[model samples]
Target chain A: MSLERIKIAPEMYEIMPPEYQDLVKNATYGNENRGWKDIGTSKELIEEHSLCAGCPESMAFRYILASLPAPEDTVMVGSTGCTSLVFPHVGIHNIHSLFGNQNAIATGLKRALTVRFPGRIKDVVVLAGDGATVDIGLDMTLQAWFRQEKFTTICFDNELYANTGGQESGLMQKGFVAKMAPVGKTFEKVRLPEIARESGCHYVVNCTVSKPNLIEKVIKNAIHIAREIGPTYLQLYTPCILEIGKNSMEGLQEMRDSEKPTERFAYREYISDQAKELLTEMAAKEKERKAEAKRQLASVKA
Target chain B: MSTSYQVLRGPEHFLPPAAASMGIRLPDPGQGHIHGKIVSEEEAMEAAARQFLSAKVPTIFPGPLVLWAWNEKAAHKATAVRHLYETLKASVTSTQQAMLIPMPDYRPKYPKINPEVEINPNHPNLTIWHNKIDACMFVGVHCHQANLSLKIIRGGTDCYTIAMCAQAGHEDAMLSFRDATAEKIMRLADWVKKLKGSVEPPK
Candidate 1:
């Protein structure tokens, strides 16, 4: 009759496309069996859906789901965009909201689950677009991080608005020709990764779609951290293939070679270090305070 | 029975539906007014022109020209705005201008006008550029970016105001004309061409 007894994670292989099943079979994050070298794996997820062929968004979406700490224990929140279009089609329980609300919804869900399941973990991930998180959803996204909510936000950064026929998003970099700025966009890219770090997110990663192996591995570690760490944001640099001209598998390599080193943003690991230091400092301070109180009590008794 | 597929599932296979975690985030009160007298299309363009002219300091272009416009209505309208900004040289007029969104295809066509700023406000170029503007115009800017731009300008020591959404809400203009139709936006373009019409590139 225990709540713990009732929980069961989904059978990921049955629902996932065959390509991922083969990919994840040997993949293990933070382990020696770094399944990246399994070159025989197919590029696409092999799902029957509306997303463009070689869509970077779809590729990252599949990899994140496959890398979950426990797929059966997962509840996905999809925002209104291309990701939402495919969320229901995937074999799992997912909640959909209008653009910009995915993180907000995921935060509330995590709080409720925490109280209900106590210390047990059920993965809650916000699968959304760059426009949703960096543009329309920025406020909600920042607030979620501000509160240190325990959840994972895997943002598919296709650079601009892809689902709506290619408009410039806040994520748009300068001098890029978009539907609105056909001549070219005049502004620079929003430093979303820096914002994630500044807003107190527990784990922040900025990587591209070219490396599914890296994407898979990062997500797996992020999921593990989310159970205890406050919040995690995985920004996958996926460009809309139709507009950008490269397939999803090679999106990273095809992306701006000049900007790669800067965009990669080697993992900060700031939150992990801070958390350890805070716990140690707080424990020491509490022990001393308690000891001082006990000494006062002994003196009074004497 | 020896199972051909060594299927192993995590204990969370039986988790409940996602309904347990859903909620909404409503916007806080906006300081910039959304409702007022719906000015005439002509009047809206006139106001937009006045805003463009009012820039005491060179205008700051905090951009995001969304390449994906939703419907026929949005598509044509966004194109019109693009045409107008190019005529205006909004980037060159900027004390600071941003680099392209890092998508190579989007960059090659447009001429480079200013040094690029990283997306974050803390970027030194962004801070320096944002600080100098006495007034800022949010042409083709989205809400998230509008908010960030507002935050940066507010932090500046000088008096600053938003020359909002290119149209200043003229009757025919989309609440903010930056996202509207060509004929509708042509009104502003006409006004700019007429007024700043005689002005030449800054030396």
Candidate 2:
């Protein structure tokens, strides 16, 4: 037997996936010394999938994947459009599903995993575009939430059917000229997070991939909360560089100023009764902890 | 961390999914069209390569597919497609290299290559000149890019399209090759460049 002394990064392994050492790491969620305790070592899991430059969907995808505590225990159900373009090439177990059926497929897969490998599946996420999430599969998505199925649903709202030459979708922002909506979409934009909350999701957030860290922190926390609670929903306003017709990064920046832009990473967490109770308990414990520290200091001084 | 969002401020729950379709048909309706074609890998490569090798004014359409399949991870690409153009430009005769057309969004990764041409969907009568091309080679793009090549095919340009995808039959692209990697794409780029200036047409 031959033995070789190869160096190992125990700290990096403790923080992130060991194989992700070569990636450009960001201090998003944790590592106070480096940054915060560290949310799963900011690594790009989606390798070699071409969308566009400064593509917000790609940014969100990387952050979401990095948030997972155990990627091997995760399975994703992805729907059609630009989102589907890259699913086949992802490193994790993924299903390149039909349009408007991301949630349905996710539900079925989760149920199957539950039956076959009980308590084995930790995460079952549905990543879909607005065309699928709002116009096409909205019913299936709502029903899945209503059923209280334990999963996280993220809607990458680029506001139009981007992959098919900028057609108007139900989720599109008003006044955008497109192939299908020449004059502009007349109907108002639908509020997805509100619907998800009403449909029984325990954690519903309306955020964007504008700031990498906020989205990363929100997604990481949302996933953890969704596992402990019921269904969780996030409407991440990721931008489409192609639709914007600008350089991808510059386009994302343009969103920050547009009359009705899309690059905003806004996080709204809806707490449930159970979560509220837990928070209350935590608050009480924290108070006692502070009081105990004060008394100990006083006694030592005396 | 706070970032700017310029749309409606709050999340709203409004219209139900398919309010009218609920009575008549399934909520989520598909086109009932799932396209699947099985072309032998050798056959696809032969047809695509032959057309690419023989053309007088061959047009190269490098889509997100090429970026997805071929771009080296730490290379100097404005997009993932920069290297393919650089490789092609490096290998081919300068006159031959000038005819390549990249999607408008993709910029050149390296210094040289007759500046990349951007194709727009809404251009007036693109089909007129689209008819003039001898062959269209598609690398790592989806239906949108293929649709442009299809225009040339529709123009009675007998030459077929050569599409390189992550997998075969994923879309309507006529030629499909599965498992395309950066190395494979680079090899293909080199081959296309080397084959570009050859004087004789293939038998």
Candidate 3:
């Protein structure tokens, strides 16, 4: 995933497709300030997604990919769902092995990467849908967190099995009438954030894709914490427009509606004392590094 | 796979070729060559057609792109795949379930297509061995997934692999078809139909 590895041969540049050229020129391979605002302006690591138009999951995917602190050294493990549909289009290396086993795979992958590159930072992330995270893969997902695996787990909680035709999922709201819940859901949505916090995650966040800056901050914080401390989880409310019978343009409104301060999906965060200390140290170090770089640039200009 | 770079100290740092374990070593990444020699699209399709018609157990391993959201021509490609399947009477063992369910609700809608068997994307070689598949073609699979699947099939079985992709062809596949458009897939089906008409089925 190093930038040196992605360099193209000079002779092959003329024959390479424009997309490849764009990737080499404009990709945020080594950019320091990676964020969601770079979506349209930069040639993103994701070439293009195959997800439905105006899908909040897609937006979250874009934000997450953009907010990765080190795209050159990140390996994402995704499970089956609407999220898998877009994995093929992402430029970074990703694995979509089995249904609901993303966390288990990421656990192993993170450990293996640690052993393989002791000096380098290789961040492993698990990205999946609500069904994969809270239902079928719950055991493995919780196991990874309990083990304190050094990686980030982000659930694109669409509330139902939207990829499998809108079946009621564990993350679905109580009384929601979905395919498997013809008489309305019998149980309340699973409290995964609280479970993750208790299960040993150093950092936890519950939010939505309605705000890109918040998404960037949480994702970056989660990755940073996971790299130094322990496991981190982010549960994003990405509503399924198709399953909810909302038009393509209404996904954002649905997300905004669900993320009201009093609503279940409202923004929340839990950080351990160790994680807090590490973040404060990291912030001060980053500021010092920026100041040093500024001083060096001024000297060159002088 | 972990990459280890060697630096040559000089006026300018010279970085040697990537040394990565468990990664495909592409001699020339831009060139079509990988596991086998690069061949033209027509040549690759011709070989694929011949293999399907002549093999005792020929299988079409359709990926999600055939029936799902690959691109605008995914529906057309699926139709061509169906025609090719009918012409060769090949058994279908799809890897679409690697990341998806093969139920009626999750099935492709344009022209409903179904596989004879669904194999896990991670261990496709198991299906190849169990079914005694001699020749298989990967249609509409993602490049990265196809690369891993091809290596697995190559490692454990003697099945000849073909990669039919819309992007640059895979280097791991024995026969690779690049820029595999809907019309090209139909042409391959037509070629297989002609070849099948001229030959007797293998027992």
Best by DockQ: 3
Ranking by lDDT: 3, 2, 1
- Candidate 3 chain B lowest-lDDT run of ten: B96-105
Q: Which structure is stronger by TM-score: 2 or 3? A: 3
TM-score, cand. 3: 0.63
DockQ of each: 0.01, 0.02, 0.03
TM-score of chain A of each: 0.72, 0.75, 0.96
Question: Each candidate's fnat, in order?
Answer: 0.00, 0.00, 0.00
> Quick one: best TM-score, which candidate?
3
Model 1 / residue A125 / CA error / Å: 0.7
Could you give candidate 2's per-residue lDDT for residues A229-267 as a string of tens digits? 778888877767767667755756754554233433444
Best by lDDT: 3
Error in Å for residue A159 of model 3: 0.4
Q: What is the C-alpha local distance difference test score of candidate 2?
A: 0.56
Alpha-carbon interface RMSD for all candidates, in angstroms: 20.4, 16.8, 16.5
